[model samples]
Target: MKRILVPTDFSEHAEDALKAAAQIAKKNGAEIFLLHLLELPNQMNDAVTNGSSIPEVMLFIKKANEKLQKIKEQPHLQGITISTTVQFEKAFDGILSFNKKNKIDLIVMGSHGSSGIEEILIGSNTEKVVRLSDIPVLVIKKDLDTFNIKNIVFASDFSKEIKKPFLKMIEFAKIFDANLILVMICTPNSFKTTSMGEKTMKNFIADFEVNNYSMHIYNDSNIEKGILNFTNMVGADLIGLCTHGRTGLSHFFNGSISEDLVNHTIKPVITFKI
Candidate 1:
């Protein structure tokens, strides 16, 4: 974890993310890149390009900069290497672009938990980022005075594709020296016998030679519910999972458990793209 990208909308939720990022950065001795996007209208962008000097656009930029500076000066962020960028682009696009250009190791951002009609319409920038980001993304929902992870619930199918992200999850767990509860969710739709589940999980763990971990087969109606139920039952501090980074119609029809967890769960989630 060398570089962390935190995109903010100047909301309380965004501050929660910043505080979490600060803790992680301090732990890893990593730099924090704080980004705020200004989704300016086409006319405003043209005016700025032509040096027309739109007062409102300039004012927005100035205020965003001021806010960013204030956040950097916050007590929690002190002594951390913080870089701020106020960009003229959509939130999701700017975040991905920044990550690629900077080679960010992780993205720690906050979600405001959308649901029902609102989610159907506007969706969430945090969800989009989690769905698309190549690097690991940690989604924080609230303020964590001390971002400690003693137990991590990692839910997966124990499939071959999960190996890549599963390794990334291990690296994250090592940072906290956390105990990993590797779970395979067995819903009725995708039911597997206990013996089969245990054998598969054992095989998966064997490849990595992981330590300080336990395996379990959880049963629920759906994957999201199963993972959440298992995590809550075990009182896990963090939830780690892999996402296929699905989009468009595929994402709509099939949906994503990782993205759903990002939107619905209050627990801090770290998603790795598989």
Candidate 2:
């Protein structure tokens, strides 16, 4: 992990994410790219170049640069290389652009955990990035003095489709030397016998040749609730998930279990695309 990208809106939640990323940067000897995206209106995009809105656009850019400069000079950033960028783009677009341009290894961002109508209406930048990015994204919801990923709860169905991402998840866990607890959520709609669940888990690990992991079958009304409940039960430090990246009416109606987990869970979530 040589480069980490931290996107901010200059909010307290974003600050929390920066602090967490700093801890990881210190440990891995990596540089942190602090980015702030100034989302401009559609009309203002062309206006910034040579039109009446030039002054307003310039003023906004100046203020954003000043904020980024202040953040770069913070005392906690000592001995850690911090690069800042203020761009004119939508939040997720800017993030993905910087990630590709800079070859970012990991992205650390903050979310306030939106759900229900609010989530449906506004959508979340963090969730969007998680859905689209090929790279791993770490979504932080709280401030941590140090990033000690001692225990990780990886919630998955243990199907053949998830095998690829599950391997990537293991590789990331090895970074922190964390113990992995593999859990499969058994909801009423997708109920399975205890014997079948255990058999499935055993075969999945054996076929993949995974080790140093524990397994569990958690029962709940839904997959999201089951994951959260089991994560809390084991006192996990991080949550791991695989996202399907569904879109349009299918996404709107059925929703995504991974996105729901990303929105509702306060714990840090590391998502691998499947």
TM-score of each: 0.91, 0.86
Provide the clashing-pair count of each candidate structure. 0, 0
Tens-place lDDT digits, model 1, residues 1-274: 8899999999887888888888888888899999999999888988988988788998999999999999999988899999999998888899999999999999998766434312421456766777778899997766778899999998888888888888888888888889999898888878889999999888888999677999998899887778878888999999887778775101211345534544456788888887
Clash count, predicted structure 1: 0
Candidate 1 Cα errors over 4 Å, as ranges: 113-122, 247-255, 258-264
lDDT for model 1, on a 0 to 1 scale? Answer: 0.81
lDDT for model 2: 0.78
Estimate candidate 2's RMSD in Å. 3.4
Model 2 agreement with the true structure over 44-154: per-residue lDDT tens digits: 887865556577788898999999999888888889999998888888789999999999988988766444312421466765787788777887777777778989998
User: lDDT of each structure?
Assistant: 0.81, 0.78
